[model samples]
Target chain A: MDLSTLTYIVVGATFLLYIGIAIWARAGSTGEFYVAGKGVHPVANGMATAADWMSAASFISMAGLIAFNGYGASVFLMGWTGGYVLLAMLLAPYLRKFGKFTVPEFIGERFYSKGARLVAVICLILASVTYVIGQMKGIGVAFSRFLETSYEQGLFIGMGIVFIYAVLGGMKGITYTQIAQYIVLIFAYTIPAVFISLNITGNPLPQLGLIGTMADGSGISMMDKLDMVVTDLGFKEYSTQLMGSKLNMFVYTVSLMIGTAGLPHVIIRFFTVPKVADARSSAAWALVFIAILYTTAPAVGSMARLNLMNTIQTGPVGEATANLEYAKAPQWFYNWEKTGLLKYEDKNGDGRIQYYNDKNPEMAAKAEAFGWKGNEMTKVDRDIMVLANPEIAGLPNWVIAIVVAGGLAAALSTAAGLLLAIASAVSHDVIKGMINPDISEKGELMASRLSMVGAIALAGYFGLHPPGFAAGTVAIAFGLAASSIFPVLMMGIFNKGMNRQGAIAGMIAGISVTMFYVFQEKGILFIPGTAEILQWEGYTKSWFMGISVNAFGAIGALVNFIVAIVVSKMTAPPPQHIQDLVEDIRVPKGAGAASAH
Target chain B: MDNNASKYWQANVRLVSILLVIWFVVSYGFGIILAEPLNAIKIGGVGLGFWFAQNGSIYVFLGLCFYYASQMNKLDKQFGVSED
Candidate 1:
């Protein structure tokens, strides 16, 4: 079959499977919509959680991030996975025992204040919306690459598919759909990786292939060979640190941890398990599922780096000196070239493409001696690295089709999860909890469906007009969650002395500070001239005492904690029953029959 | 007057402290502050510190959770607090 037909068949079939699951498992009641009736099996919940967690960020961008950044990007691997450990140990089981429909509901009830719940609703919306934009971009990239549509057109198509199932199925529909998505995505991600691994290192497992022998008989280390390639190209050694400061890395990692713990979509996954023990087990299982991707990413990165470098820069696998523009570039090159992600410039009057580091003019001199002007890969977008991998290695058409379907599965699954989270927070927490206290469960469910529609429209708008840097948008989302939601929930569950006033104040403070920092950096939103006064570019580079401003969420969280603690101390203590409520949550014995409130 | 309840709490705290230590060591310990010193060691052509940063800490975290869960289950039975 032709590439276009093959891709269309795979993508179309996957969408049908998702919509079919959404219809078959349509959420019947409020309970079913919110927490899948609190009866999801541990393994199934794990897979669903993994799908919810991985997002397009994990599937498409992670390997590209690692491939470009080398070892430093490991923070993403460690921080993201380490977050699950925190979730499993510190939050999930207790939150499950507290037995609420949403993270904010727990905060509001535990803190005994509507104000606190409202603050949580705000934070959840902000974090989720920003993160969804990244997913939308991923969908656009996948659609344009596979279907040959323009990016805007691709986003519209992506949004239309999400609306069908997400509006119809809700959380219950999403959970089962996510399970199937997890399977497709994992298969899509791994198959191409294995093929590349075999071709490059003669090892089928990309994880082991990462450290295996190079295709060349030279016996040099893979990292060493990689270091030599980029360095030869006038770039810093692959092992050398370039942009970010160490203090900044530490702060960034910590920020990610806090952000991961605070995300509404991930936290809500814990609510699906029947018992507190199951919740705990599910958290670990979620990590186990997530680890499959986390572990594979670096292997993919290393292998892609080696294969890319060997194919383009040097001899056919082993020789030191190879022609720069051999026209031998794989089909993946032409495919991605149409997307403008791959480009060529014949600098030294040589027809071959030279991809050396332009930063090092001295090395450019050596390459120029060989009639090469400079490096040719000017627009190699990172997003193309994963989706283009199979094509890069000349894999079969089905494998390429599967990657397209996989990318869609990842984006759609995460978008569905986020949309459900937004809808529930609106209906369950903001509306039912705040606006209409007398509203019945049935009415609230209706309100939820309405909210889902609204949220999808909003996401569609962003997808059409995506921000300049999609990844930067995701970082801000993380910062918002870190600063706002995580702190409020943590204090609510663990600290009995916290008052409603303090909880509300802290959340507002955290969210506001993080938003101010983000808005200040991106001046396009407001009148550009005043951006210097309101915005702080330095925050991204360094925060208080030289920490990355992304860590502002953690600091904002700290402010909330301190303010809440101090205010609670100055005021009257929490009532005796509330104190006892905290204790009850700690004990997991009667968790089986617990309320799914 | 329940010996088992006190015993359970004691065991729980002890196990939690131990696991937390391991967690902090592998993540904050090996990945950040001690990374340069630890990178001196190599495993399978990668630096030991880099391996820990990328994969080792996560494996340890998973192991830690299982250990904690099993021990907690044991403590629950011992303290007459097993889930019904």
Candidate 2:
């Protein structure tokens, strides 16, 4: 009946469903644990991949980021989804034909060098660990909001749920659970969007509603109205705002695209499907599923921004009733206020809430003339846009509950996927492949489970006390993956001349350069107060050639390509068998079934 | 490489090149580099550039995936390399 109770019921039900799937799909062998026994249908695998790929960032944070950032956020949408095309076309089918359990294994066998495999393992761990930290943050936030607990406690609970399914069923359980998660998250995401769209633009599809006529019969389109509303309040026009330098945006988009394709968690999902062709088709299907949310995001973002501004700035600036009185603020305002993410101070002793661009001196003068000292809403966390949307729009309690469940589903699914990637890289690639080559299948499975537990604990710790490097960490992770993993994998597949020396050198160069750039900007290993180069104040400019660290992956990747090619040419050619192995992976014939061992 | 296998691989490379060019054009070209020029042209309610960035490129990506898949399958069959 109440919001909390409804949220509890929905979130509790989803958790129970995940646990049930885990128990039912409990992996019996290494194959099942790692790749779901390679029996997953293409469509099902695609849905699973969509769930795996769309983390808390996509489900919870992306639309909120777009809401505030406007057109500049297109980098995220295009960058993230466009990578699937590269995956399907360049990597997935070939990797599927290779029939490997982990990415490192492919590198190990393809390059015919354990050292190259180890480099890949390190890169995979760094990127995946960084990614899991973001997921942990999402889980903590979603849990804190829905369960009304502290962020730390929410993180612990989220870690426990992931431990259950991931440790027990591995990829098999994660796959099925992710399918369920995809359904829950997509529905939760779209329902609020549809409602907002219809209410705002009289269009049912949010995508169309974003560009459709206003429901108020204002004759102007929704975009034009939103632009007028914000610009009228001294904010930039939503449709035309550039995020950063166009060069940075371009490079950022390229980094994210390659990073999405290179992520170990996403690439491994294709390994679960039945055939090479299935891998390609499944990537398409995954994008199709992801696109449903991606397309709706811009609509939800612009609409939510419009609604938010209207809520605070009710009319034209300088008008007597322009700002909403604190006493008359909506229930959603009070609700988010309790979380401390939304706060207001009665500056100028004003009884009303003034949400405006106080940083603009011109606007400040106008605000001063209206007896407003400064903006009262001191902190409005961008993350609250989606979570608070249903309540903001006066939707029923069930919709809010579904959103809570959806956010948790997204965080949990992606967390499980990342944990799996970490676990497999450690257990299969490190432990069995190198540490104890004679490890039994049973021993390996146990190691994988143990690694999952360890990975979850580490991720939870980072979530609780996110590093100073936490700002834009997800983009950094993407950069690392794009720079290090994607290039090597592409070279390994497409270039027969690629040898072990080249692959290893390229990975090291790419990851180290990307890390150096990122660490110089963010901090060393994201430890606070460790940045050698201050971003804005340093004598030497922080970025190189006007490129932000987040966008330097393309440069790092270029360096890798050049270094690898040069090194390979200097070194001996790969052994004849290794050349044949590359040739073997290029074709679809005689591709044996995924091994059960 | 055998003749059929080489032929199939060539065909695959050709398709990928074409699709990738389209991908580059839609996303990096219309979406970013030429966004200003393209924005001068309106679509539905948004600018053509914004539409390409936000919506059109994604649809094209989907089409490319399916097209690549089907074409590859046909090529695989022609080369007698379709997996059993």
Candidate 3:
């Protein structure tokens, strides 16, 4: 079958499977909608959590980021994965023992203040809405490429599919569908990787293939070869290049780790499992599952870089036939060009595609010596590395089709998870918990569904425009969560003396400082023309003490800890009942069965 | 809190501290802070630091999670607080 038809069939089949799961696991009550009736198996919940955590950013964008950024991108891998350790150890089990339906509920009950809960809800919404926008953008990109539709139309279709399962089945439906999605996405991601690995290095595992010798009669290892090839073209060495300063990388990693631990969508997944032990083991299981993809990512990235460089440079630089003829470019090159993500302009009227760091003065001198006016491949979107990998390696059409399905699965699964978190925070925390304490379960369920639709519409709108925000806003989301939600949640669990005033004060202070830094750097609320100051010319410089806005969360978190501690010391201690509640959450025993409501 | 519950909680905290220390050492210590010095040592075809940053630390994190779960469960059993 043709590539387009195959993509449609594979994507259509996955969508139908998700709809089927939604029907099978249709939520019957508010309990089911909110927490899947708290009966999910540890392994099943782990799979769902993996699906929830590995959004479009992880599946679609991360490898490409690594492919281009080289060693600097390791912050994403370590930061994202390490945060799960913090979650499993510090947060998930205690939250499960508390047996709450949402994160805000825990804050509300623990701080003994409706005000604290309301602040938490706002933080959760802000972090999650920004997060969902990225996922929506990922969905649109996947759809636009595979379905051959405009980005806006693709986003609408994605929203329609998510609306069906998420609105009907709630967490219950999303959980099972996510399990299916995890299977589809992992298989789709690994199969092409394996094929490409064998093609490149004769190693079946991409992980080993990354460090293995090339199969092309080159005695040198793949990493060494890649380093040589790119550097020969004036790019930095892949393995040894530092990403920003060591301190910045340290702070960025910390922000992402804490951010991952605090994302409400991930934290709430633990609530779906049957026991506190399940929550603990499920977090482990989730990381185990996520690690499968995370470990394979570096291999895919380095190998894809090697393939792209080889495709363009066909031979050693300075040689007459070093560049690939523009007229005879490979099928994968043409395929991506049709999407306008890969473009070639012959500035020197040359017929060959010159791919190099034209910005490098030394390389520019060499190009000038060769009578080349400039780099001819005008644009190569980094996102195409994974999507175009199979085609680059000439894999079967069916494999290419699976990749499209996998990308969609990744985007949709994460979008549904984030949307559910946003909806539940509004309906459960805001509406039922506050506005309508006397609201019926049926009414709460209706409110949840309505909120899901509204959240989807809002996310879709942002996805269309994608504000002048950098692609790395995934880190920004983590920074917000780490600064605002994580510190307060930790205090609620670990420090029983934490009072309402301190908790609220900490949240506001943390979120405000983090947002202020981010907005000041990116723009006010990321509006294009609203940036108070512009980025430094020639080089990206840190705003405060060599710390980029992306890494400001650690400082914000520290500020929160100090402010909360000082305020708590000055004010009255938490009530005895609140203190008792804290003690109750620490022990694993008598984690009462999740209430049906 | 009962003596047994207090003891169990203490054990949990101790175990978490140890594991988190390891977590910090591998990702932040070896991967970032000490990355330059560690890059002198090669593991397979990659630097030890890069390997930890991309691969080794993630594996350790997964192990830490399971290890913590098992240890905490044992502590729960010792305190006679294992869920029925």
Give the alpha carbon lDDT tens digit for every residue of A162-250 in model 2: 88889999999999999999999999999999999999999999989987989887788888888888776667778878877888889
Give the 10-residue window scoring lowest on summed lDDT in candidate 1 chain A: A316-325
Worst 10 residues of 3 chain A by lDDT: A532-541
What ranges in model 1 sit over 4 Å off?
A: A240-243, A316-321, A326-328, A361-372, A467-471, A524-530, A535-545, A592-597, B1-14
Candidate 1 per-residue C-alpha lDDT over A459-543 given as tens digits, one digit per residue, 9 for 90 to 100: 9888887656555777788888888887777777667678777777777777776666655655544335544777445444344
Considering only chain B, report the TM-score of each candidate against the true chain B. Answer: 0.89, 0.94, 0.96
Q: Top model by DockQ, which number?
A: 3
TM-score for the second chain in candidate 1? 0.89
DockQ of each: 0.54, 0.80, 0.84
Residues A1-597 of candidate 3 have per-residue lDDT tens digits of: 898999999999999999999899899889899999999999999999999999988888889989998899999899889999999999999999999799999999899889999999988998898888888888888888888988889999899989999999999999999999999999999999999999999999988887788898968878889999999988899997777788888988888889999999999999999899999999999998899999999999999999999999999897878889988998888888988999989887768888898999999999889878888888989889999999999899999999989988898999999999999999999999999999888888999999998998888888877777746577778888999899999999889899998999998898888887777767787887665464445434465778888888888888888889899999999999998888889998899877733
TM-scores, all models, native as reference? 0.94, 0.97, 0.97
Q: Give the alpha-carbon lDDT of every model.
A: 0.78, 0.89, 0.89
- In candidate 2, stretches whose alpha carbon ends up further than 4 angstroms from where it belongs are A533-542
| Candidate 3 lDDT tens digits, B12-84 | 8899899999999999999888887887888877788888998989988988999999998988888888876
